[model samples]
Target: MSSELAEIEGQISDIFRALSNGFQKMDKIKDLNRRSRQLEDLTDKMRESKRLIKEFDREIKESQYKFDSETTKLLNEKKQSMIKELNSYVALKKRYASNIDNKRVDLFEGPGDGYAEENVMLASTMTNEQLMGHGNHLMDETDQAIDRATKVVHETIDVGTETAASLKAQTDQMSRIVNELDSIHFSIKKASQLVKEIGRQVATDRCIMALLVLIVIGVIAVIIVKIVNPNNKDIRDIPGLAPPAQSRRLLWHQD
Candidate 1:
């Protein structure tokens, strides 16, 4: 019984450890989601900024229509302001890009012995036998991380490619101020669609979880009715009444 208790305790510890890891994974996913949201917001701001620049260009055209000679001078002033704003916006994007680059670099270079450090800490808590048995499983998690990272890399590459293609199409084909504004409008619409996609994915995840819970509750109910309740029936029988045993056996066993 002591050994059973010890094994149970170990199992429970392992379960909590798994729960902690799950929470950590949830946190990482949340961080990625937050980053995605930030990127989406940035994209929005970029589109708005682009629209503003285009509007300023429109202002130039209006000024030209009203004042032909002074139009050149007014247009130059407005154009300079737009260029300054754009440069500041590009600088902000550069900073974000740098931060992302640092994170990716650290992940690839392997930060300070990584899993080896985790293994040492884990080893301190277990007996040699337990460590030997579970060590392979722990190592397997490293491989899983690599696979997940590779998947993330591919996804990011796809996003980059799409973004580049959209930028190329807008810039190459839409040089006029009106056309540029339309392109910015198109980008905002695209962002809204992406947000809807994210919402749908979240809803899908929640529905699957609800279904799983219902399935588990149904299974437990069936087990209680079939196995647990029958055992409890004897306990519920009154002492004054003949024990249910002989009668139950006879009822079921009779040909």
Candidate 2:
């Protein structure tokens, strides 16, 4: 009977040992499962980060491409406008110079042949001093003709001088106008450059704003997903179930 009791006791001890070992293995399996879940969550977070980075890269590239296209278009427009204006100014200057030249030529031209013919007729009609007595009268007529010719010559010289002075004044005015046109051209160029710079800055700012908006939207989406799916406890929820602070900082830095 004692041997039977001892055998029963040994069997009970073996059963207990086997049960303890089973419990330990079950605990170890549970721990392994928890660690695996954590690794999976970390992997998901890493994937999300990679996806966001790719999105940001794509957005930045697109923004840069848009800015470049707009800048090129603006530059072309400005160049065409400036060229047209300069051409107009040049044409005007040419027309004015041509008109001035024509007027000068007309004003300084020689007298007609009618005056010469009249002088020849008068000389023919004059007697060798119809009598030496009329010689003085012929001399007086000759002197009067000389005086008239001198007066005509003097008047022509005065007219020519006045015309020359007028031409000179016009030339000086044209020169001044040309200088003003040059100044205007320079100012226009500067203005175009400034506008280009401002446009670029505005484009850059818009890009930054778009990036910020995307980041904010992403953050909101993450929050909504966390709130809607209670079981989906992602590592991103560590900071009050919001997006990672590092991501926000990165977005700011990109901006």
Candidate 3:
């Protein structure tokens, strides 16, 4: 009985150990779940970052386009204004020259003192010279303006090219980030699968452990029953135990 008790005690100990192992595994599973959630959060953050990057890229492109459009519009307006000013200057110069020619003819033909005519002719010549100088100055200013405008346009184009290069670099960086995200997603998926597999294995182990515990309990119960019911005829006889002999009564005969 003591031996049987010891055996049962051992089985109970084994059951306790199994339960401890199961608890440990459960803790591991909980840890895995926690890590999985953390990975999911990280993935969400990465995606958000990527979205922000794309938004920023779009804004930059829009700003660049707006800048280019405004610059071109201003340049075209300035060019047109310059052209109109030049045309008006040429028309005024032609009218002034025709008026000076008529005044010279009248000064020569009309009755006038020689000194007065000389003064008139001299004044007209001085006016014409001043007009010519002014026109030359206007031409020089126009040429300078054109050069400056061309330089500005070239600079704007260079800036645009640089901006495009920068955008390309940013796009490349985004691509790299996307690739890294893909790899991270793959890793997370693999980890989740591994966790699931572990859970399945643990469940299987738990079921096996429960069956083993039931078997142990059944064995202990049978041993206890056998120990408690000594009169059970089904119990096997022990070696060296003989059957009881029938007693014969001796009677004395009367004479």
Q: What is the C-alpha local distance difference test score of each model?
A: 0.65, 0.60, 0.58
TM-score, predicted candidate 2 vs. hidden true structure: 0.37
Candidate 1 residue lDDT tens string, 23-103:
334335435446545645555555655655565556555546555676567556755765575565556656655666677
> Number of clashing residue pairs in every model?
0, 0, 0
Between candidates 1 and 3, which one is better according to TM-score? 3
Please list the residue runs of candidate 3 whose C-alpha ends up more than 4 Å from where it truly belongs after superposition: 1-132, 226-255
Error of 3 at 29 (Å): 72
Tens digits of per-residue lDDT, candidate 3, 161-255, equal: 99999999999999999999999999999999999999999999999999999999999999998887766753224434433333112211211
RMSD in angstroms between candidate 2 and the native structure over all alpha carbons: 53.9
Name the regions of candidate 1 deviating beyond 4 angstroms: 1-33, 112-255
- In the range 64-119, model 2's lDDT, one tens digit per residue, is 45457765455345434434533443354345446545655655664534367876
Question: Of models 2 and 3, which has the larger TM-score?
Answer: 2
| Prediction 2 global C-alpha lDDT | 0.60
| lDDT score at residue 250, model 2, on the 0-100 scale | 82
Error of 3 at 240 (Å): 23
